[model samples]
Target: MKLLVLFSLFFVLCSVESLKVLVLFHMPVKSLSILGTGVVRHLLNAGHEVTYVTVYPLKNPPTKNFRQIDISKNVELVANDETLTMGYVLEHQIEKNGAYQIQVFSQENARQTFQNENLKKLIQDPNEHFDVVFSDLLESEVYSGLAVLYDCPMIWLYSMGAHWQVLRLIDHGTNPAFTPDYLSPNDLPLSLFERVEELWARIRWQFLKTFITQPEERKIYEETFGPLLAQRGRTLPDYEEVMYNASLIFANEHHAIRDRPATPQNFKYVGGFHIEDPVQPLPKHFQDLIENSKHGVIYFSMGSFLKSNSLPKKLVQELLNMFGQLKQTVIWKFETTLPDVPKNVHIVHWAPQPSILAHPNVKIFITHGGLLSSMEAIHFGVPIIGVPVFFDQFTNINKAVINGYALRVNLNYDLPKGLSAAIDVMLNDDRYSKKVKEMSAIYHDSLTKPGDEIVHWVEHVVRTRGARHLRSPAFNVPLYQRLYLDVLAIILAAVYLVKYIIASFDTKKAKKQSQKKKN
Candidate 1:
């Protein structure tokens, strides 16, 4: 019994050995940072030492094991630029200019990140080591070099749903026929025209990637990581190889909320990982306003990237006038104060979005249809009116509309009447609320909480030393072989040979008949 007890204790200690984790999540968006912080928090709770590189640092470090390398100034230089804002996106429709603009911005951001003094120090330190590295799978692939620097496995964290760009790294690209591109405004069961459009969109993106994006990214990759790799006496691998070599990817997606695609074993869905458990109570003023409201409330916010004050003055007045007609109290997340505000319309420079969605008196949510907001609405069982502005917002809102939980409103000067009509439908019809509640139940029915799943998988990769067994075999197969082009070539050659031989025989027979007739 003494020997058995000792063995059990030994196993326990072995299983819980603290791991050194390095995290890089430098995206300027606050929502993406929320997901990254959640990951850092869970790793710290599991007794792991973490070195986090982020734009949004924690106000107070959670523990001594947690260390942050602040890169907010570097990211802000790119993020605060006016050309990348929501107003710019709306002016130049995403189909034409938004994607290219974002790519350019991401390239500049990557350059700035490599130049950050603190990040440079960390990379140059001879004593720095980590058991694993977690990096954001945004447009830039320069950070993957850190995994190579530490000689540890890399895992990618995607801030949105399963996109073809991310999936192509793990497995074959998703078929554009059925799976819409991330920027596409259409969904499944697509019409013939939609499929053609989707295919063209994909081809155009691939063309841009091959001709424009990849070359620039490769240059940055070599310029930033070349010295570090040379110090280690190793030549850099191909940029494609480095980007596609991740051991696993944790996508902010769930089959419950989105359609399930053919994902590989390495692609794990852990959506809503940022939502706090035992959600904190609202502040006194917010609680009082929500609880004391005579009529239910309607919440409006365009998310962090788009400022409500950026709207045209005429449209703003139209919205105010529309809100004045509503009997329900309106809570708008505007960035600045406006004059002549309606008594029922309350304007807050900032609002606690999740807390507001959780309130029982909140009847409807009018949003910009960001994935994070859509997920939150579904999480709290609140139906929404989505006003998608750009990027994946169109796709996310379309999914909600197809799922019967949300209505979409175009962002235009004439949004007031349209928004009011959608609000009426939401308030009068119970179907949207009931459908959203059902989705909420599904979102909550997972076997393990998102936080637990994150920790388990992160440790799993570290314990298994990259977990290569989980990777798809498709990675090893060449495109020609996978498409059976060689087999098709062989069959075509055999058919041509048979036809040639038959033609020769027929000619000989015809000549023999001619000789007999002459004789």
Candidate 2:
């Protein structure tokens, strides 16, 4: 009886020591989102103990062993935050510029969703030693302390919408958005002006990084986390260490979307992670309508958050006019009722997006260039015409154009005729269809399902103490240190001393020679 009790005690202790991970994604969850769904699935399947936290509630509850931590529960939302207005406006403009320069000194296009209060709640717990962390890079500073508190490796995931900072932060390259010279998709050799653009962007990003990552910010954060460390019997890690110690930098996208090289060793591309549930059945009425329609279908949607009807009155009118001109049936995912509806146009507040995309007769998708929508179009072998309003929509369209799978039209009043022309080109031409079909095959191959890859990696991190081998050593090396300016400084000082001494000796010799001649 004593032996059996001792063995049972031993097993319980073993379980506690096994791999533990904390996956933090402080973003709003949208319907059929792969980040929210796929991450939970992967972490659970990997057998690593996982905990998820967010700024807001998830649409679908967490599955498997993952527990969703409603961060609002622990931290109070600012009762009256004056900063809210500036913050929101700044975020919008930042998205527009495809770059962010905060206060003209600190600048990068990473998400800042982590409120100060969120950091406090994470550290208040004395005993939290996660083996590794998988964190969304946006507002990653929130987990800066958590990474240290656990004394573990971290994997930084990129925004589902790719940006230039992904290369800059994880791989130590310049932001490609600002420095398009180095990245030419058209296969054209860059001009001298383009070369200057690349060089200036590199210089600008370096300056921005130096300005933003300050000693003061680190000091304040350490001060906050120090108390938590004291309780746990651990010392605090430096800010540089906290930032660089991540194991792998993954993204919420697949390489098919953007397959750029990482200039540094630490970044790995395991994207296409926006996994969604299987296609759901269409509602009875919608299904019946689709079945009865003789002509092929055309699906129109503006995505969530932004209402297509919210546009200027003329813009809405133009869209109706264009839809009325088309012979194909239109299923418009408009959130509100329009003043006049065409016979062929159907408006619904919401639609099962994946299902509508799956319909065989559905030819082209009109979207806001959302990542999910773009991915869906590619995944289902459908072509697209994007109307970019904001955010990654521009990049999405650019990539789609580069890939020959889609076209873009800005929200102009003239869009009725322009949209009609673009739509006619797509429907008449077979190239877009062939291109998207080719992309779809590559998007989902037999071996690497996005969900499985994410699971394998999440488990790899937990199993191998964050698989620290994947972390970038460049993060540990300071920017100045990376430039190797110490060596340069030494060389310059030596050269200057030599030049001064040589000149002095040469002058003295010349004077001596002159004196000798005069004597």
Candidate 3:
């Protein structure tokens, strides 16, 4: 019995190996950082040492194994830059040129990151080492250079659903015929014209990437990483090749929330991983309002990026007037104080969204359709009315609408009536609640919890020395071979040759016939 117990202990000790991990999530968005921190927290809990490069550090006290490198100044810079706001996005019609805007902004962000003194020192240190590097798969691929510098496996974490552009990194199959672009507001089963539009968008993006984005990124890559490679007696790899060399991609998406496209073996879905289990209790005021509401509680937030204060005054008045008439209590996350408040409306500068969503009396969520918000709503089984502002918010809302759990309203001055009607329908209808609850069940029904799955995969990569076996074979194949363009060219040449020979023979026969006649 003693020997068996010792053997069991030995096996357990052998199974769990602590790894040093480097996590880079410098998007400066709280939602994006939340996803990264989720992975960081789980890794720490599992006895791994973590060095987190973040704009938002963990609020909880740091443990011995955790090290946070503060980059909050970057966040402040972005926040203070009015040009990066939603107002500018609207005023300049930025979404029309979102690809170019994103590329330019990402390059600038990466440039600043590389210039940070702490980050620079970390890179310059010869003794610094990490078993694996996890980075946000935002528009910036230059950060992947860190993994290359460390000589470790690279993993990408997408804060939202995986789109075609990022999927191309791992050579995952993408069919625009059915799958909509991340920025596109359209849903599946597209019409003929939509398919044509989608195809054109893909092609145009490819051209832009080749001609514009790639060159810009390469310049930054060479400028930043060239010296580091020289120090290590190594040469810089191709920028595009380094970006494509990721061993795993963990996307914050699941089949229950959206259509499942064909993905590579290395692509894993871990949506709703950030939602706290056994959600914490709401503040006393919030709890009282929710419990005492006769009809139900409605939660409204535009997420962290789009501030309610930024809304046009006339539109805000309209929303306030609309909310004043609702029978249910409304908890609005408004950044500024408004005078002449409605009796049934409560304004909060900040909201504990997950806790509020978990409340039994919370009926409907009025949101901007950000992926994290959508996932939280689904996790707690609350239906939402999405007023999407830009980018993937449109796509996220469209998916919820298709899933039958949410309604979408455009953000405009005259949206109060439409929004009121949507709220009324959601409040009265039971179908929306039922569908979201069903989705919540599906979201919860996974082999292991998302956090566990993430840690397992992270350790798995480190344990297996980069898990090269899991990579898609398509990664190695050239585009011409993959698309069979070379084969098509050969077939076309053979056909042309046959046609020429047949035409020549016919001409000779005709000439011989003419000669006979002449004789």
| Every candidate's lDDT | 0.86, 0.64, 0.86
Each model's TM-score?
0.94, 0.79, 0.94
TM-score of 3: 0.94
Model 2 clash pairs?
34-275, 111-139, 253-271, 253-272, 254-272
Error of 3 at 263 (Å): 1.0
| lDDT per residue as tens, model 2, 1-519 | 999999999998786443566777654434223465556666666566777766555667656556666653322333243332322332343234322323121111111333335544655766556777777664234356677777777777765533455555554655443435222221113467656655665566456555654444565566667777888787877776676556666665566654444445445555545535466788998887777668778898878645564456666787898899888888999768887888888888889888888777888899877777887898788899987665556667767887889988765556677789889998899899899989888877747776777666666766777675765666557677889999999999999999999999999999999999999
Residue pairs with clashing backbones, model 3: none
Tens-place lDDT digits, model 3, residues 251-293: 9988686686778888898888888777788999888889999
- RMSD vs true structure, all candidates: 2.4, 6.0, 2.2
Question: How do the candidates rank by TM-score, highest first?
Answer: 3, 1, 2
Clashes in predicted model 3: 0
Residue 384 C-alpha lDDT in model 2: 95
Shift of residue 381 alpha carbon in model 3, Å: 0.5
